[model samples]
Target: MSAAAQRVDTGRAAHGALARQLRLARQGRSMLFPFIGRSRRFEIWAHYPRHDAVDSSGRWQFYFHVHDRAEKDSARHPQEHGHIHLFRRSPQGKLTHFAGLALDARGLPLCWFATNQWVTGERWADAASLVRELAHFELRLRGPLSGAGLWLGDMVRFYATPLRQMLEQRDAALERHCRRHDQTRAQAWADRRVAVWSSLPVNWPQDALSAAGPLTQ
Candidate 1:
């Protein structure tokens, strides 16, 4: 288990840059706007949730979007705006899907969840392995994508406890599904009908306002 696979102390709120960028983006438009500067407004809205935030080293990345994404039949999980998918590219170059941050129409985070393979077309990693990667998900290289990576890393730290809990529930859900249905069907987890397997309600960060800043030189 490398340190990158473990949680560590992140510096001050400077990494809150991602959230700040999101806020500025919403200044005159809608939820999660100002994407890469804009392309005819909502014309590109809801389009596969662009990967605006990324790590130069490709170790970790984060991207978010909004739309109706919830079980149509079940009211247990009310659909909100959309979700942010976090990714990690291993040294072996394998792309692993970590977890998702569900957001409201107003761009506020509502829940944390894990999706089946079909949803994001990503390789599956057990909850334990994904948990370890959360800490080292940082992007320090100087570039357009740097701030977003740092901001995402901050998000993992800020909601570490709750995120971990939701992932546990995700694993439990998969086990229950397999036992009741068919264990031999490895692709069962990739069923398109089930987008989000497990989720936990999230409280919007109070520090978001503080994240805006009064930077001192």
Candidate 2:
């Protein structure tokens, strides 16, 4: 892995950014307002931003969307409004999903998760490769969503450790499923029953405040 991939950040920046956005949301301008503003009626399974939020470098991208009711893991995240799926794009345009950040109605993150290949139909990559790509995650946008982009990037750094563990757990789960079912890795990857490979909940409001530290100072 590259040195950049090993870089991590305190969540202060993310917490401050989110605090600002939340204040705005209370006044009717949400971080999600940019993407959902034009939709007459936002529908489930429809990815906000249409094409997606590609970073300035075009190598990183993400989009927010809600899954169909049946696909939601309400047992784990009852308040999940949706999730932001992050992807790493190759120069040749092959896209690899690295992680997903589930958020509640107020746009606060609820958890980070890893999914199977069939979930995103992405160019499957190992946890180590995905971890290496983490240092390269960036999304510099200029608009109402600019701060939102920065917050998203900060989130990757904030939860880097858990994200790494989740990815590793995902891989391990896949291996276990393959062995238990006597199926090849490829077959296990395509198994519809195994959608979410791993997930870890975020302890919200309290955790966010703690990570933010003394923002006023």
Candidate 3:
């Protein structure tokens, strides 16, 4: 098959996988229901599942958590209920943050974003490298949260093009920030003032529809 045909097939698969997951999760309650379980309270900064969801091989992992109201930069993400931090384990066993997805109260995706090093305390990777690695971000696990994990992976794959663009924008933003502050990229990368470096809004339902016709440009 042609490369273009392969891409279209992959994009459609991702969209179908994600849509199915969303349907199953919503049959009982909101999509967040599985991950949050029956907890009456979701404390700020506390990782839900009480532990992150890691694949059997410990390669890919993710966790959902809410920020304290006081800690949120309202001007940036005013409506977020929480966000999932996606990571991949390096050969050295260090978890590297590649991308993040923010969600609203209904557990619908709001946007895709990349943050400075200090935000996730991740092993630093450039945008190009991260984008390349994103294709391997599948989550293979078992039990109730397994569906949630699968949904996350499909979300990344489905939004692959835009996510790559977001990462590129992140790198560009970092360069400009460093220049504005007269600091090296490394220095700016560690600056708390540069928490969320780049972000792009997402509407998953519409995106899924578009994916069925032609792969996003």
Instruction: Put down candidate 3 lDDT per residue, 69-123, tens digits, no spaces.
Output: 7764843567788898888787677878878888888777788888788888898
Residue 59, candidate 3: alpha-carbon lDDT? 80
Selected candidate, larger TM-score, 1 vs 2: 2
Question: Per-residue lDDT for 44 in model 2?
Answer: 90
Candidate 2 lDDT, 1-217, residue by residue in tens: 3544343255554565667667766678765666677789999988888888878787888888987767745334677888888898888888898888888877777888888888899999999988876555567887656767887877777676788888999999989999899999899989888878899888765666676665552
Best-to-worst TM-score order = 3, 2, 1
Q: What TM-score do all the candidates reach, one by one? A: 0.71, 0.86, 0.87
- Please tell me which predicted candidate would have the highest TM-score against the true structure: 3
- Tell me how many clashing residue pairs each candidate has: 1, 0, 0
The local distance difference test score of each candidate is: 0.60, 0.77, 0.77
TM-score of 2: 0.86
Q: What lDDT is obtained when candidate 1 is compared to the true structure? A: 0.60
**What TM-score does candidate 1 get on C-alpha atoms?**
0.71
